[model samples]
Target: MRLSHLADYAVVLMTAAARYPAGARLSATELAADTGVPLPTTQKLMGQLAGCGLLTSARGAAGGFALALPAADISLADIVEAVEGPIALTLCSDSNNHECILDAHCRVKPHMGVVGNAVRGALGAVSLTELAR
Candidate 1:
C-alpha cells in the first residue's frame, strides 16, 4: 500500500531530525526548509510527532524538538504509526476497526494479522539511522 502524503512528510521530517547530533533541538521552520516540506505541514507534523512521543518538545529561547530516542532505537514503523496510526493493510485486520460489513463471514480477516505483522516487521527493521544515511 502507498503511504499518504502526510506519512511520507513525517518520514522526511523525521529523517531530517535524525541527521542532527543526539539531543539537538531543531525548529520546524528550519526542518521545513531543510526537507522542502511546507512550514504549516512541518509545524503540524512536529506537534503530532511530539504528541506521539517520537519527538520531545521544550519551550524558551533554546527550545525546539528533539528525538525522544536515539536514531538506532527509532524504527520506520514508529514514525509511520505516529502519523498514520497502525499499519493495517485491510480494515478487517485492525482491532479498532469493526465497521466492515464482511466481518461476520470473512475468512480472510483472521489471516490478515500475519500479513500486517510481516509488513510492520519489515518497516521496524529500517531505522532512522539507516534512513538518514
Candidate 2:
C-alpha cells in the first residue's frame, strides 16, 4: 500500500530533524523551512510526534521540539506509524478491523498479519540515521 501524503511529509520532516546534532531543539517553522513541508502541517505533525513520545516539546525562548531518542533509536516505521497509525496493508491485517466484506470465506485473510508484520519489519530496519544520509 502507498503511504499517505502526511506520512511522507512526516518522514521528510523527521529526516531533517535527524540531521541536527543530538538534543538540538528546533521549531516547526524551522523544520518546515528546512524540509519544505507546509508550516501548518509541520506544526500539526510535531504535536502528534510529541504526543506519541517520538519527540519532546517544550516552551520558552530556548525551548522547542527535540527528538526524545537518539536518531538511531528511531526507525522509519516509527515515523510512519506515528503519523499514520499502524501499518496494515489489508483489512485482515488490522487487528482492530472487523469490517471486512469477505470475512466469511477469505483464504488469504489469516496470512495478512504475517505480511503486514513483514512490511513493518522492513520499514523498521531503516533508521533515521540512514535516511538523513
Residue 48 error, candidate 1, Å = 0.4
Tens digits of lDDT, candidate 1, 1-133? 9999999999999999999999999999899999999999999999999999999999999999999999999999999999999999987788886787787898998999999999999999999999999
Task: Indicate the TM-score of model 1.
Answer: 0.95
At residue 121, candidate 1 shows an lDDT of 100
Lowest-scoring 10 consecutive residues by lDDT in candidate 1?
95-104
lDDT of 1 at 19: 95
Clashes per candidate (backbone, < 3 Å): 0, 0
The residue-level lDDT of candidate 1 at 25 comes to 95
Give lDDT per model, in order.
Answer: 0.95, 0.93
Q: Give stretches of model 1 more than 4 Å off.
A: none
Residue 110 in candidate 2, Cα distance off native in Å: 0.3
Residue 101 Cα positional deviation in candidate 1, in Å, after optimal superposition: 4.0
Off by over 4 Å in 2: none
